[model samples]
Target: MVEQLSRREGDCFLLTPNRSMSWKGNIRIWLAAFILSMLISTGMLLVGAWPVLPFAGLELTALAAGFYYTSRKCQKREVLTFSQELIRLEKGLTHKEKEWELPRQYTRVWQDVPRHPWTPPKLHLQFRGEEISLAPFLNIDDTEELVAILEKKGLRVEKRRRPEKLWF
Candidate 1:
């Protein structure tokens, strides 16, 4: 089913549920991420000797920021839509929302699906004239479907020469 929804507080559109994606996969990965973040944060707290507290505090804060950003990014249940001139995506937590903009002329969309049951598909979009990837959380199918739709709408999509490493 093709459903279109307006982004809550933006002049953007969201297209979703061409088919329901596997939330089990998304959940497992998020669980792993939470555990990994906790483990690293705890390890830093325990082993970082002399400057321990302060350093650990910083590390924990960074982790919190990362988690907050990630959760905020994932809160929405929609994939964004755009035309050839502009692209916008909505993400963030319950009350605080964030949006990102990419001029279509300066962005490239890349799609990759790894071989892991819990690994959701990812779409890596690079902006800054290909120097930085602005957003990279979109799952594989979402990426492909969105790309196809956008391509049909005449947006430029490019294939990456190499896979972009997603380190979150």
Candidate 2:
């Protein structure tokens, strides 16, 4: 999602991945699954199916790990600050892990055409000779919104319009 930040100097925008479920939500889901797995494992153990017990434990462990990693990824975000002289991009989860400072005039926002209709065009910042990816987690609508917002900030290179289809 794209959010505007109040800054006395210049424009600031916060970019975050769309999260269907939060950390707490993920934890709740994991807990429920763990309970179900334990109940089934315990039942199988009573029937002399001891192998299922270990497999269930391993499955629950893998599920927990997958949920944890995904929740962490969802926490990641990027902050873009466009001041008069410099354009600063900060990326991190909870804290600033990486940052890039480029000249405002040298930074340009561009995108490549999407291969699929449902997918949004991938946005990138052209700085000198390098291409820096921006908001790769955004969906179709949010990606277009970000492009529009960047265009208002005079950072957009070209516009890509969505095709209209009347047939459902």
Which candidate leads the pack in lDDT? 2
- 32-92 in candidate 1: lDDT tens per residue? 7666666666777677654555655566567657655555455544335464477765544
Candidate 2 residue spans exceeding 4 A from truth = 159-168
lDDT of 2 at 150: 79
Q: Which residue pairs collide in model 2, if any?
A: none
* All models, RMSD in angstroms: 10.5, 5.2
lDDT of 2: 0.86
Tens digits of lDDT, candidate 2, 1-168:
989999886889999999998788989999999899999999999999999988998998899999988888898899989898988899999999989998878787778677579878888887888878888998889988988887887775664554655767
Candidate 1 local Cα displacement, residue 159, angstroms: 3.1
For each candidate, what TM-score against the reference?
0.43, 0.89
lDDT, each prediction: 0.55, 0.86
Could you tell me the lDDT of residue 81 within candidate 2?
90
How does model 1 fare in lDDT?
0.55
